[model samples]
Target: MRLAVVASHVIQYQDPFYRRLAAHPDIELTVLFCSAEGAKTYHDVGMGTTLRWDLELLQGYDHRFLRNFGWGEGFFRLVNPGLVPTLVRGNFDAVLFMTGWAWLSAWIGFAACRVARIPIFLYGDSSYVPDEKSVRAKLRAAVMRALFGMTSAFMISGKLNGDYYKHYRADPRRFFPLPWAIDNERFVEGSAFAPGERDAMRERYGIAHDELAVIYSGKLIERKDPMTLLRALARMTHPAIAVFLGDGALRADLERYASHGLPASEPPSFPVSQEAGRPGGSAKSRAAFVGFVNQTDLPKHYAMGDAFVLPSHFDPRATVVNEAMACGLPIVITDRCGPSADIVRHGENGYVFAPGDDAALATHLDALARDAEMRARMAQRSREIIATWSYAEGVDGVAAALKSIAGGEQT
Candidate 1:
């Protein structure tokens, strides 16, 4: 089958499921991008920037880049005039829509497919259970209900996300709960380095093996609440080392705090102390602040950790938490994180601390650090729970829905 994927970026890490859909053999895929080439990078999805998304990756897929008019965004309306004819001429079997911003493009594609007598399957923003219903969300929900009722089935991350569409009056049977997917091969194969070789690895990076390694892999900005992790670690009066692997506007402030932790003898690599605002009180522990890490090289660092922590103030759905869970790492996340709310069973799979509660975070951190048996129990559960969320399983759910929809075509 020939399929038209409706979204902004054609291929990237931000939309793993869509990318896999493109790579699937049973169907041929075409991408519809709404934004400019280099305007923004969604999540860690490097579309226009990275060559890793070369010809090899999108070999079987066709690409179409949409350009906006006069004021750029405002010109999107102009493209509407030609979008339908263009899609109709492509002779696509179906148009599969994704991304929230692609709402207009999705509408245009939907119209074109109807006139041409082709199927259209919608995905993305349609899947999530918006934390709350806003005036805009209510309108969107109404529109999606209408669109979904007419089109083929779409995908959702889980039961709750799909239930949102039904609440907004969408047909629940047509809303398939297609859980999130990840590259299982990467985690399963792992990096060249092994856990026992951590000592040599630390020495290569000029870090000490004796020092406790606390790792945080995400943006340093407030949304991620990197400060909370810092505060929690700083509050703990003990021997520990903290590593940060991401960058943003907040770099300067975080740098200052790390500098203070760096020994005076070593040329202050990080800031000595925050001039604008102190990290506040004694640093919970020693910190090593490094900028963003490359995805290919990120796993080794994750594997070389004592514990993985993400104290997001409020995250939509933490995918990296899933990555950590798959790697058998003991996690410490905040309740505000959507993934933690759904996956974390509190001391079962992993532990969840109250948002902004440094004392509570520190208590868990200290407890996990001192207790090896508890960490092992949590780690074992992590691996076990993650096995159930593989892309194969998620795709099986999607395939069943697809098969049901496509049945009786020969008749």
Candidate 2:
């Protein structure tokens, strides 16, 4: 079977899934990315991650970009729908759309596949909540209702996400929970961390050998609630340092609030990572704003922490939580994180706090910080849980689904 995957951004991270699909001798895959000149105008983060376009990754498959095609976003769509025939000429047996963020791409791709009578599958973790936009946006959704209704199947991440599609009037029979992501072997290999490497990372980050460290990694955004974490630390008494990973618009505010001990904590025993590196010896910032840790270096970063904590205000699903768990780092995540439900085993593996519950979040933080034995046990359990779910299993599940669709399985 020939499958054409449509996306809007650069898919450098999807190397594993694409490689798996490419390796299938029975399946020929074509990845269609949106043009970068086209991407500059697209403002959706979800759309960018889904499309994985413009920027190319060195891979074995034939991936192409359709820049001339006008998307409703970035560039206003034109009436010239001739691109439909061009995509159809690829003779794809199935069309898998990566997301709905780009209405032009999803809508046009769906239309083109329908013109060719090819089976279509939509893949994403989005819920069907109205954006409260203008009347034209509402009409666009109405058109999507008609088009997506014809989907052969869907690859969603959770029951909540599945219900989102059902609310859109999609066929329940076609709704399937196929979670996004599998550990890239590259990440897994990075997980083969040597004790010396961990020690080196700790030294490089200037974290004391015995400091109760809780690391928060990811883009520093309002949704991530780095400030709330600071507030939570304000309620705690443990002498823990928060290693803030990733950069975003809130850096200046976060850096200013990160004075002395972390939120929910007593007093800090040591200086902040940056302060320690500095001469004045006053970086006592709880939120050490170490921005944008590289993807390849994440394992080393996670290894530097005694535990992981992400107090996102409410992320649909913080994949970093999964990455932390995969790295065997016990986590203190909020209920807002999707992976918390599956990975966290309450007191067994880690603690979960309600979003923005500074007091409650402080309690969990103290539990992990004060009880060293429990922290180690939880970290061990994190790795064990990750072992049960391998990238190979995720790939097999995807391949089986594709094969089932080919075999005329009922929706």
Winning model by lDDT: 2
Residue-wise C-alpha lDDT for candidate 2, range 1-411, written one tens digit per residue: 787877655544564567777787777888776554333334434222222134335368777766645645453442225448757787777777775545555667777877787788887766436574899878867866876677887766655567667767888766554565556345556767665877666655656665577788877778888777778777778776678777777776776676533433332344335532433344444555566665677776776788888888667656777678777788888876766656577888888888888888788888887888887899889878766555455455556557767765533
Over 52-130, each residue of candidate 1 has an lDDT whose tens digit, in order, gives: 3322233344666666432344325324445577788987666666653344565666778788877666566333455
lDDT of each: 0.61, 0.67
Model number with the top TM-score: 2
> What shift in Å separates residue 381 of candidate 2 from its native position after superposition?
3.0
Cα error, candidate 2, residue 126 (Å):
1.0
lDDT computed for candidate 2: 0.67
Q: Residue 251 in model 1: shift from native, Å?
A: 1.6
Each model's TM-score?
Answer: 0.77, 0.82
Least well predicted 10-residue stretch by lDDT in candidate 1: 46-55
Q: In model 2, where do residues sit more than 4 Å from their true spots?
A: 36-56, 68-83, 127-145, 260-283, 388-394, 407-411
